[model samples]
Target chain A: MAKQDRAIRTRRMILLAAAKVFEERGYQAATISEILAEAGVTKGALYFHFKSKDDLALGVLDEQDSHFVVPDRACKMQEIVDAVMLHAYRLQTNPMVRASVRLAMDQKAADLDRSGPFLRWSNVIQQLLEGAQARGELLSHITPARTADVFVGSFAGIQSMSQTISDYEDLMGRVSDLLRHLLPSVAQPSVIASLHMSGSRGAVVHEEVERLQEHDPSALAVG
Target chain B: MAKQDRAIRTRRMILLAAAKVFEERGYQAATISEILAEAGVTKGALYFHFKSKDDLALGVLDEQDSHFVVPDRACKMQEIVDAVMLHAYRLQTNPMVRASVRLAMDQKAADLDRSGPFLRWSNVIQQLLEGAQARGELLSHITPARTADVFVGSFAGIQSMSQTISDYEDLMGRVSDLLRHLLPSVAQPSVIASLHMSGSRGAVVHEEVERLQEHDPSALAVG
Candidate 1:
């Protein structure tokens, strides 16, 4: 068991090092030698875990997937939306998440399967939207899949924007504001009301608003 | 005058060839020798126009910028929105635009002060958003600069998504549908109305709706 744990740790260390190298130098330019040097792993250990550089990249992507855990609670649509916003906020603050974002954007070939991080998040939201729809918590006409695509695509865009603009500190608030505008058009009144009612204590929702009001008043207008 | 005209034409030819080489081989892999070979120009001619490979890449960016002329006439906000959507539609069909999209997203660094295509588009959108705000077309609270970032970033995301999911024929429609959901929230009502009205004749938008109707009825129901 101890030997197994050490192997696992070594594998993770390699993945982290490879992710960093790929993020810095890009997929085509990044070398395995740099990854081994960074991870302090022998070539044999690296080869034991991954067959080739492509396989190593896929392993890095898989490791990335493990880190992006969505909260597994039953909540209203707004709560889910807030969760998504907070995820973006956390991603903005975390260096690993930032590096992953850069990798995701640059590693276009790695996204052959539509089931990447962005799409997985979209699926999670789609499932929630389906639940919302079955409960009549969404507009009868709002298609869960299409709504999911728009939401995920918009969030990806927002995250990219937050990265670009240095002065825009309240990314979560802007995300929340954008969601508020969008939700009214697709969500049922009950869902909207539930979200607003829960807004005070919901750390994801309220914290975003408070942070926005403090840092970026121009982003969130009360009216 | 003839000599100056010849020099300008030769420069344009070199830049066009460089764009192709950069698109095919990417920035680091593409070399001046390959660019000169493709352009059928001598090394002396290539050096006469561009100081280095980086300078040549920048020249390609500058040449692409010349094609992105903002519409001269100002109409309703919807007209502007439709114009933008139509431009996106053209990008869906045009190979040059598609290549440019790949270059902009996968290659360019995110810094605005740098001479990359993404930053150039970001700046142009910033100016347009500011102009819209000054005309009372956009909400007063939203910062033009941040909005520009969101707009440009979202466009990139959507373009990337469209490129991934559908063939070139269907890309514009998917992009248009995504934009329809998005434009309503940020753009004025008149703009929204104009976009929907124009949708009747928009080959790409109508075809997308038809395609959705045929493949997935749920998508049309939402739209």
Candidate 2:
């Protein structure tokens, strides 16, 4: 069990290093040697976990699976809001998520499966909207799948614009504004009136996710 | 007169070649030599118009200034819709805009003015929305600037998503869906009911722009 834990630790370390180097230097220009130096691990140790440069990139792509539990809210629509807010928060402060987004969006790194994150995020939104629909939270015209696509695309664009304009420092505000413009068309008036669309909600969720993680270590274990 | 015309033609050729190269190789990896080869111009000719590869990139950035005159409609909100639909149309078919968007969004190309286009686009929408407000075409609570920002960000995100998922084959549909979701919050019920949001609007705008340009060369001369 101890040996298994050590292996997981090494893999995590390697992935972090790879994420940094790949983001800074790009996948084509980034080298395994640089990753090794950044990781402070031997080539033998790195190779034990990742077989190639592509393997290291795949690991980083999967590294986007950072889990934090948000307790059930009164409105599942609010949970949808919280999910995006949490992601924006992490995409701002979390190096791993930032790197993954960069890698996935990089046209130069076309070989990487960039669609995985898009699909996963859309799925998350779809699930929340489904719950909203079940509980009479959304409008009659709003379809979960289609709304999910819009949410995914809009968030991707907002974060991207924020990244370009302000390095995501203003992403929370932009995202808040986005939801304000969009949610009226997606949710019922009663639900829309109750939802929180503040950019600062990210910071709140960030703190909450952190608190939850400390309280229950297993809470962050998302697939 | 002959010499001046030659210079103009050479400059246009170099800009097109540079846009193609930048789109394919990105700013960092793109080479002057590749651009020269693509343009099929001499080194001296290329250098005569563009001082450096960076200058060539700026030229491509400016090349996105394609102008088309969409005729005035009953609803100003429809004009905003037409503008985005037209842009989506142009973005699908126009190589220069694609390259410019790619260049502006490339984080590695941090040396370039990334926010220039986003600000320009948002300003366009803001101006339109302000007009809509004056005419009472918009919702009472909507702010032009914030709504414009959301419009720019959402379109960008949708376009990017379409590029990733379908290489923009479904861009028009996605954009139509986007405006449907957004216009309700931005426009009055009467305006929203009258707006024509469709994928084919792009091709129509493209033809209109072309016809206008054909009749008046100055029509395309946007700042």
Candidate 3:
């Protein structure tokens, strides 16, 4: 059991290091040697966990998907807001998530299949939007899939802009502004009014997710 | 005058070659040797025109900003739509414009300053939105600068998403959908009813710009 725990920890350390390198140097420029140096792991250990740089990149991308969901909300609109806010918060605070986003948006990484994160995000948001539509929390003209694409694309652009502008220091504010402009067109007025579309909403949701995880580790499912 | 024309043509040819290489290989992977081969130009000619690869990229980035503007419209909102639609049309049809956009969005080009396009776009859109507000074509609560960021960011994302999904074959449709979703919440209902937000808006605007340019060479100033 102790040996298994050590292996898991080593794998995580390697992933985190890869994430940092990928985020800084981008996927095309990042090297396994740098990752190994950063993680202080042997080449054998790194190879044991990830066969190639591409595999290591995929592992970092998968980190964004593992076990961090926003806590549930009564209103589906609010749920969507929390989900977006939570991501923006994590993007501001977490290196792994930031690296994953960079890789997914990196057009220069011609060898890497960067479609996974965008498609996965669009699908996840589409389901939540469909649920919102069923509950009439959204505007009548809102098509779940189309609106989902807009949300995903806009968030990607907004974060990219923020990264270029302030290295994501102003990401939460920009995200808040985005939701403010978009939500009015997307959700019912009542729904929009009730939703917390503040820059600080992310920090609040992050706390909630953390508390939920502390109480029940299985609460990591998508909110 | 003949020699000047020849110089201008040669410079344009080199820039086009650089744009193509930059679009395909990105900034870091792209080489001056490749661009020279692509341009079929001598090393002396390339150096005479561009000091370095970075200078060549800056030249490509500047191409997107040069002299393509929508014609005038009485309605500022329509003008804003036309500006966006015109750019979308160009992105779909023009290789230089597409390459410039790719560079602007390429996160892997750490040495390249990608903020120019985003900031310029935001500033342009902000002025248009401000004009719309002054003309009472916009909603009462519209904050021009913030809303401008949303438009710029959303458009960037939508185009990037379209590129990833279909190589921008469906960019017009996606952009039209974005305007449809966001316009109702932004403009007055009457204004929204009067605006053109179709996929074909881009092609129509493209034709208009072409006709205007042909009629008066001096009509290159932004609308």
Candidate 4:
């Protein structure tokens, strides 16, 4: 059991190092030697965990959506907002999430399949919108799939712009503005009125999610 | 005059070749030698035109907005829509534009400042939205700057998604969907009813702009 725990720690250390390098140098430019030096792990251990740089990038991408799950809300619109806000908070605070976003948005990484993050995000948002529709939270003209794609794409662009302009210092504010503009178009006025869409909402959601994970440690599993 | 025309043609050839290489390999991985070979230009000619690879990439980036000006409309809302649709059309039909978009969105090109395109786009859109507001075509709560950022970011995201998913074959349809959702929130219902937001708006706008440029060739200057 102790050996297994050490292995897990080593794997995480490697992933975090890889994320740092990938964030700094991008996928194509990042080297395993730099990641190994950063992690201070045996090359054998790194190779044991990830076969190639592509595999390492995939691991980082998977980390973006693995652990952070928002608790359910009565209103699906608010639930979706929480999910988005939580991501904004994480992007501001977490290196892993930032690296994952950089990788996913790196058009230069020709060998890396960058579509997973976008597709997954769109699908998750689509499911929430569909749930909202079942409860009549959406407007009559709202199409869950189309709206999901728009939200995913818009969020990607907003975050990228925020990253470039302010290095995500204003990401929460930009995201709040995004919700303000887009939610009204999709949700009922009453639902939109009740939802919290502040720039500070991310920090609040982050705390709520962290507390929930503490009580149920299994909820924090890193996939 | 003949010598000047030859110089201009040679410069254009280098820029086009640089765009092709940049589009394929991205800014970081692309080399000037490859661009020279692709352009079939002598090393002296390439250096005379562009100081470095960065200069070449910047040249391509500038091309995206240089020749493709959308003609003004009485309704600024339609004009903004035309601007966006025309860009979508160009992204489908133009390689230099694609390369420029790739560079603008390439987060890995740490040496390149990608904010120029986004900021320029937002500013342009904001001006149009402000015009719409002045004409009483906008909703009461719409802030032109804020809404313009949303439109720019959303369009960026939508285009990236379309590129990844379908190589932009369905980009026009996706962009039309984007305007459809966001326009209702910003534009007055009457203005929304009058505007043409179809996927084919791009082709029509492109033809209109092309005809205008042909009549006034100076309007198509490669800035």
Best-to-worst ranking by DockQ: 2, 4, 3, 1
* Model 2 / residue A189 / CA error / Å: 1.2
The sequence of per-residue lDDT tens digits that candidate 1 reaches over residues B1-223 is: 6999999989988877877876676666677889999999889988998999878766765543445532232533443454456556656555555555565555324331222555666677667666667777775466766655556666666666655555345555556556666565567776456444343334544366456557766533110
Q: Tell me, what's the RMSD of every candidate?
A: 9.4, 2.4, 2.2, 2.6
Instruction: Give the residue spans of candidate 1 off by over 4 A.
Output: A72-75, A107-115, A164-181, A188-223, B63-65, B70-75, B107-146, B167-169, B187-191, B196-223
DockQ of each: 0.27, 0.68, 0.62, 0.64
Candidates in order have lDDT scores of 0.61, 0.81, 0.85, 0.85
Can you write out model 2's per-residue Cα lDDT over A1-223, one digit (the tens) per residue?
Answer: 6999999999999999999998878777789999999999999999999999999997887667545356567789998888888888889888999898777677656566667777777887888889889999988988898899999998888988899899887888898889888888998898888877676887887787778777865544242
In terms of DockQ, which candidate is stronger, 1 or 4? Answer: 4
Interface RMSD of 1: 3.4
> What is the C-alpha lDDT profile of model 3 across A153-186, one tens digit per residue?
8888899999887889988888988888788888
Give the DockQ of candidate 3.
Answer: 0.62
Q: Candidate 3, clashing residue pairs?
A: none
* Residue pairs in clash, model 2: none
Residue range A48-131, candidate 4, lDDT tens digits: 999998899999998888665777778888889989998989999998898888888877677778889888888888899999
**Cα-based lDDT at residue A144, candidate 4:** 95
The candidate scoring highest on lDDT is 4
TM-score of each: 0.75, 0.93, 0.93, 0.93
| Candidate 4 CAPRI category | medium
Tell me the spans in candidate 2 whose CA falls farther than 4 Å from its real position: A66-68, A216-223, B66-69, B216-223
What global local distance difference test value does model 2 have?
Answer: 0.81
